[model samples]
Target: MAIVKLSTTERRRLSVFFTCLGLAIVAWIFTTLSSPLPFIINEALVYKNSPQKKAFHPLQADTIKITIQGTGWQMLFSKMKPDSKPITVDLTPLESRNYVVLSSQLKLINAKRDANQQITAIDPDTLYFDFTNRLTKKVPVRALLGIDYQKQFAISGNVSIKPAYVTVSGPADRLQKIDEWKTDSIKASNVNESIATRINLQPVTEGNLTIYPKSVQVNIPVDEFTEKTLDIPVKLINNHNYDNVKVFPQKVKVTFTTSLSRYKDMSDDLFEATADLDLWRDHGYSTLPVQLTRFPPFCKIVKVSPANIDFIIKK
Candidate 1:
C-alpha cells in the first residue's frame, strides 16, 4: 500500500488533539475512583441451610431490622439484596438479653469494593419480644332471642343452648372478654310450636380471641300446651234514638296461649265489641247500631262470630 505523508501543521494539530483526549480520559477515571459506593438500610440478609436450632418459632414475627454503611451516593441508589430464605432467630434457643449473630447475616455488594463499608446494629444486640402463653378456659354462653316481639305476640320455646359452656383461649386480656360472648338476636314472632335453630356467635370485642367451637345449637319451646280465655264485656255503640234495640251476644271470649305469669295480668276489658251505626243510617233506619268500642292492648282480634246485629226501632 502507498502511504501519504502529512505536512508539519497537520501533524501538530493532530498531536494537540491526542493530548487533550488523553487528559480527558485520565480526569474521568480519577472522578470515578473518588466516588463512594452505595449502602442499604433496613435490608435483610437471609441465610439458608441454617441449622434447625436457629430456626424461628412459628408464632414469632418474621421480619428483622438492619442498617448498613456505605458511600452517600451508593447508599442512596443501591438496593439491599436478601437471600431467598428468611433471616430468622430462634426464640426458643435465645437466652434472656442474649442474641446470636450469624456470619451470613450481612452481605456487601462487593466485600473488596470498599474496606470502609460495614454492617452495624442500630438497636441492642438482642431483640426482646413478649410472647403470650396459650391457655384454655371454659366460659358460660348465653342466648338472646326475640325479646322485642309485638305486644300481641309472645316468645316461647326452650331457648336453651347445648354445651352451655364453651372453651376459649388467647392472650389474657382477650380471654377476659369471653364471659361477655353471646349469640345474635333471634325471632319468635307468632310462634305456635316448638323451634330449634343453629345460631352464629356474636362478634368478639377483643383481638386475638379464638373460640374452640364456632357454632351453638339453640332450642326454643313454643308451647301450644296451655290456653286461656279472657271474658271481655261488650260495649254498645251510640244509643241516641234507639229505645228498643238490644244486642244478641253481650260478651266476647278472647283466647290466647301464654304462661301463667302473663295470664294473670290479663283483664276482661281487653276486647272492644261495637256495632256500626253508619250502616243503619245508610239503610234509612231511624235507630243506631252497636259496635266494638275498646280492646286490651295486649289482645289481638281473631274473629267476630256475629259480625252484625239488627237494631229494632218502634214508631
Candidate 2:
C-alpha cells in the first residue's frame, strides 16, 4: 500500500481537534454530575425511646432504603459509602401502636442531616415490630482475668466488683436464658500491686435486650507472700475398735506461703493434719500416710514433713 504523508500544519490541526474533543467530553461529565436528581441508598436505623414495659424485635431488617434528592456528585459518593451513620428513629410511637410511619419523622431526621443531601422518602414507609413480654432480672457479673504475678506476690483477697450484679431487661424467654454477664478480659503481667480499674461488660448483641450501667469497677487486692511454718498435730481417724494405737510422730511441721498481711494471723489451729488408720487396715499397708484434712484456702502448702507415719498397735 502507498504511504500517505501530511504537512506539519495539517498534523498540528489534527492534534488540536482531538484535544478539543477530549475537553468537551470532560465538561459534559462534570455538568451531568452537578445536576440535582433523586437517588436511592440504604441506611442503617438506630432506635430511641424503646418501651420499658415491652420488649420489641423488629419484624424486618434494621436498615431502610432512602430516596435522597441531591447533586449527582452527592449521589455518587453516597453510593460509595453505604455505611454512613445510622438514622435515629424514635420508637415512642410503638407504645401506642405496633407500627411507625417514617414520613412523620422526616422533618426531625432531616434537621440533623446535611442540607446538600436531603432524604425525600423512605422505602416501606412504615416500620413494624413484634412485641413480647418484658422481663427484668438481675444476674451476677463474672470477671475474666489473665494475670501473672511477680515472685512472692499474689492476690490477697477475693476480687471485688463494685456492682456484683447487672440489671438486664429484655424478652422474658431471652432473659430467662441468661444466667450471668461477664466483663471483658483483664490481662496483665508482673502484677505486683493491687489493681483498680473500670471494665466494660460484654455487649448485648440482641437489639431488643438492654443492660444498665455498661461498665463496672474492679478491685483486686494484691500482696507479697512469705513462708510460714506451723507444727500441726496429726490426729488419727477411723480407729473404730478404740484400740490403743499411737503414731510415732505426734506432730508434723507444715511449711506454706501466705500473704504478708496475714502472716501474723496464721497458726496451727487453721490447719488439720490426720493419719488415716483405714489405709493400713483396709489394704494391710505397713505405714499410715499423713494427709492434711483442712487448711486455709489462700495458703499454698509447700512441704509437709514425714508424709507417711509409723504406728504401733497393741493387741
Candidate 3:
C-alpha cells in the first residue's frame, strides 16, 4: 500500500500549507462566535405573581440585561453571576399590556447559565406596566413638632394626636390630593417637660402611597412657667377725641410667662393694655407705644414697662 506521490512541486507545497491552516481555523471560529459578551444583571427581574391588589408600579429592582455567548476566554471563566432564578414577570395574570417576558420565559434565565453560557439575550425582551385603583382615606394627623421651649415655657393644650386620625391608602388620583397627614420632623429641645413620643408619617412616598397609622401619638403639653406682673390699665386706641386724649402712665407693667396650668387662670383680665393712639409721637412728649391688645396663649411677653407712653395731643 505504498503511495508516496510527493511530486508537482510537492503537491503545490501541500496545497499551500493546507490553505494556510484553513485560514487559521476560520479566524479562530470567527472570533469565538461573534464575540458577544455583555453582562449586567445587577439583580431584579424576578418578579413572580406580583400585583397584590391593583398597585403595580414597582418591579425592576436590579436593572437586568444579561447577554452571553462567551469566547472572551469563556466569559472570563463563566463566573458571570446573576441568575438566581429570576426573569419571572407574572403580575397576577397580567391584563393590561401583557408580555413582560414571553420568549418562552427565557428558559428561566437559561437555566441559571454558566455551562456553555448561552443566555444569548434578555433585555426587556417584552415588558409593560401600569396600575392603580386602591384607595382609602381618613387623614387628620398633623404634628411635625420641633419645639424648643424652656426660656419661659410654652405650648399648652391642643397639640395632641393619639388616633387623631389616620387610614391613608393610595391612588385615586393620589387619594384626591390628600387632605392631611403630617408628622416626621418631631423635634424638641430644652423643653421643660411633657412631649410624649412616636411620630413618623411624612414619607408620603408617591405612586403606591399608603399611611394607615404609620405612626402617630404626639402629646406636646409642656407647662413650667410663672412670671406674671400685670399693672394693667391702658386703653385708648385711635384716640381722636377719646374725651380729650390723655395718657401719661395710665398703667403699663405687664411681664408675661404663664404655663403652670394656666398659672391660676392668668389674671389681669387676660390682658389688653392698648395705647396706640395711632402710635402718636408728635415729638412733644407725646410718646405713646404700649400696645398689647389681648394676649394669652402659652404667654411669654416679659417686658413692656412704659415701653413708650405719655400722650396729650388735642389740636
Q: Number of the top candidate by lDDT?
A: 2
Q: Which stretches of candidate 3 lie over 4 Å from their true place?
A: 1-169, 172-177, 182-193, 199-209, 216-221, 225-227, 231-244, 253-257, 260-272, 275-291, 294-297, 300-313
- lDDT comparing candidate 2 with the true structure: 0.90
Sort by TM-score, best first: what order?
Answer: 2, 1, 3
Which model, 1 or 2, shows the larger TM-score? 2
Candidate 3 deviates by what RMSD? 20.5
The segments of candidate 1 whose C-alpha lies over 4 angstroms from its true place after superposition are 1-129, 147-153, 224-315
* Per-residue C-alpha lDDT of model 1 across residues 1-315, encoded as one tens digit per residue: 999798999999999999999999998876764576444345333223322222222222334544455555454345444322223433332433233443333343224234555545433344433345556679877888674444433544345888787777666655665565688877666565556898887764322345657678888654333356666555655557665656555555556555444566666655566665545656765433334566543344555544545555455
Per-candidate TM-scores read: 0.31, 0.69, 0.30
lDDT of 2 by residue, 211-306 (tens): 988999999999999998999999999999997998979999999999999999998999999998888889998888889999997789999998
Going through the candidates in the order shown, the clash numbers are: 21, 0, 1
Q: How much does candidate 2 score in TM-score?
A: 0.69
Model 3: colliding residue pairs: 43-62
C-alpha lDDT score of every prediction, in listed order: 0.53, 0.90, 0.70
| Candidate 3, residue 145: lDDT | 69
